[model samples]
Target: MDIEIIAIGGYEEAGRNMTAVRCGRDIVIFDMGLRLDQTTLNEDADIVGMQVADLVKIKAIPDDSVLKANDGTVKAIVCSHGHIDHIGAIPMLAQRYNAPIIATPYTTELIRQQMAGDTKAGDAAKLMALKAGQRYTLSQNLILEFVRTQHSIIDAVTPVLHTPEGAIVYALDFKLDRTPVIGEPPDVARLRQIGKEGVLALIVECTNVGKKGRCPSERIARDLVRDTITTYEDDKNAIIVSTFSSHVSRIKTIAECAHEIGRKPVLLGRSMEKYATIAEQMKLVSFPETTSAFGNRRTIDRTLRRIMKGGKDQFLPIVTGHQGEPGSVLTRIATGDTPYQLMQGDKVIFSANIIPTPLNFGQRHLIEARMQLVGARVFEDLHVSGHAYREDHYEFIQFLQPEHVIPAHGGMTMTAEYILFAGEMGYTPHATAHLMKNGQRVKIR
Candidate 1:
């Protein structure tokens, strides 16, 4: 059997991550995602109703038209997690393929919600739930297994395709944290066992390869949040935190800390409510009893009014817009567009790093200026990264000593850095380790 790895979108940039693995006539598609920076350019962009061709033209979603020339039938569309950059394009792209969308139970629910309004995608694709440590047989020649893994979001896994040639491991977005806040640590024992079994090709993420040392564990982040929030336990000032809404573990930590400080946790904004509500409904996570969430704009405004009326110091608002996106809860509050007023000595804690885009940097600067103008004290970077650093990637390579290495989920600089790191392990560039771009392919066998 001939095996080839195709880089669809994420290789050239950090988002819109889609990759296809073709084994003879059978092809398995992985992660139909979106580019947030591109998609968010127009604040009022109607993405749900936008055509795939239009999104492709604007470089928002993966241009899967490259697949038409590749001779193979798509067997399955596998999603790694529920992050918008990982599963965001499902509504626009999954309908084109006659295959079931396979993801963890939480991710499946998110996908179902994502495809709810799109008649074409909703009617065309079937959603399937596969838990971590479970195996699904795609065909006689292909066996799909979801190896347990830890990431920012809960229920993350590294999908492995067991083929006749060897096991093709897809480790796009994951970490090797021994002590995760929400789930078990990455299944190191199983990954080592797979390494012994023979891995043909390993497609891995290179987002943080340029950074040295292992990435800090989420436990450390939990402690940081606890230390920061507990300091103001007796203070009379309002405290608000902005972070990634999909990061349930982080949100749980924030909510618990708020409860510990004797303040009610109020989750604001649409994404915050959606991710947390789904996780709670699935019994994956539970927030404090004093926690409440409001999603719709009207409800969110009403909740903000209630918070203001009750007293700002009585509640800790965990909201969206850590990147200072336009119209986000934090942005609205900073710009005085929301009912929630920012008074002097009010605390605004950003629990997320800027996503490293020119637009994000400018927007974050603008929001910080606005908050400062209101005399709100700003605390930044009270969080850790979800991507694996250099040492983590080294340890990962040690776990899966595959024949070929394909660095993904980043641009040329990131992938090039990974190639250099792989060289330190005796892997030659393009010979053992490969650097790829959008719409490119490499044959391992």
Candidate 2:
């Protein structure tokens, strides 16, 4: 029995994450995603119309040569979760090899949503809903177990691969959130059992290795929302907020906070509204009543006009564009495209950070400038990360106790930074922790 890992794309950078786990003739690919780089993707360029041809040219997707030997040998394509950076490349890659995609309910739906317009290949995927802790065998050589974990999104999973050589765990995108907004915490007992039984390797997310402290629970973000609402309770101003669409927990917190402050919460983004439907379908979070919806610029304008004319003073509007996407609802509104104008002191909150990219910071500055020009009070970074920090990564290493740990989901700098964390934690056997790039494969036996 043998194990092979193809650290495609994102293993060395911040996007286009695809990893292949092979046991003899049977192979499974986890996460066929895209990398978002404007210099690479071209600023002002949209991805919706972009096909695999364009993606390969920009090197935004993984080099398919890594899967050459195992092309048609794929038994299953297990989706670890539904973040675009992890699942975005699937519509183009899933059909090359015939395999049923296995994912949690919400993730499966979200993937379907992502592949909406790609009729040429979207129908080829056979998506099977995987419940947490359920084990499913794909072939004689490969078996998969879905272990639940907490992330910013709902129904995220860790794929435990059972091979003849040993068990390989893919803790793809997970945080130890005991008190999560949508699902139960990670299955620590199962992970420990696998470690005791002997794990060949563990691939963990290394997004925030150098950062300190455990991630605040999704509940803490909720509490922050509650506190922010209370802090501004006396002000009779319209409140507009923006955050990650997949952050159902944060949205739930904001909803509860809005309810407490006696305001109707109206979600106002296309992605947010689309994901809210799936979140409710998965029972992760439910939308509050009296919430208005508008995704398009024209509709948002009409909705705001109605809200203003109706004299709805205490209103909480949540839109997209915190990362400064120019076309997003918030930017359009702040730029005065909306028929209703905000005067004096309308409150606008950004529930996410700027992610520290120069382009992102530049865009954020422009958005802030627009908001200030309109006399809107802007508040930013009222949030926390969804990934585990330095101490938490060490704690996970202690718990899993795997023979090898390959840090993933970040660039060469982040990868090197994680190497320091491992050294401090006595994670010797650095040879076992393979540093790889797209098309690179590591053999384990």
Maximum-TM-score candidate: 1
Q: Which stretches of candidate 1 lie over 4 Å from their true place?
A: 41-46
Clashing residue pairs in candidate 1 are none
RMSD of 2: 2.2
**Cα misplacement distance, residue 65 of candidate 2 (Å):** 2.3
> Could you give candidate 2's per-residue lDDT for residues 1-445 as a string of tens digits?
7677878768777878888887877788888877766333321223666677767768787777667763448888888888877877777777777779888888889778667746645563488888888999888877899887888778888998888777888887888888886668888888778878888888878888878888888877877776776676468777878888777778877776777777787777777777776787667677677655566556766777777876556677777778887777777777776665766788888999887788888888998898888688887778988888888788788777777777778888887778777767666634767666667777866
List residue ranges in candidate 2 displaced over 4 A. 39-46, 70-72, 428-430
Instruction: Please give the TM-score that candidate 1 achieves against the real structure.
Output: 0.98
Residue 145 displacement (Å), model 2: 0.5
Residue-level lDDT of model 1, residues 1-445, one tens digit each, is: 9999989989988889999999999999999988889777422123677778888998889989889745689999999988877888899998888899999999999889878856657563489999999999998799999999999999999999999999999997998899999989999999999999999999999999999999999999999988889986469889999999999999999999999888999999888998899999999999999999988789989999998999998999999889999988899899989899998999999999998889999999999999999799999999999999999999998998999999999889999999999999899998989999899989998
TM-score of each: 0.98, 0.94
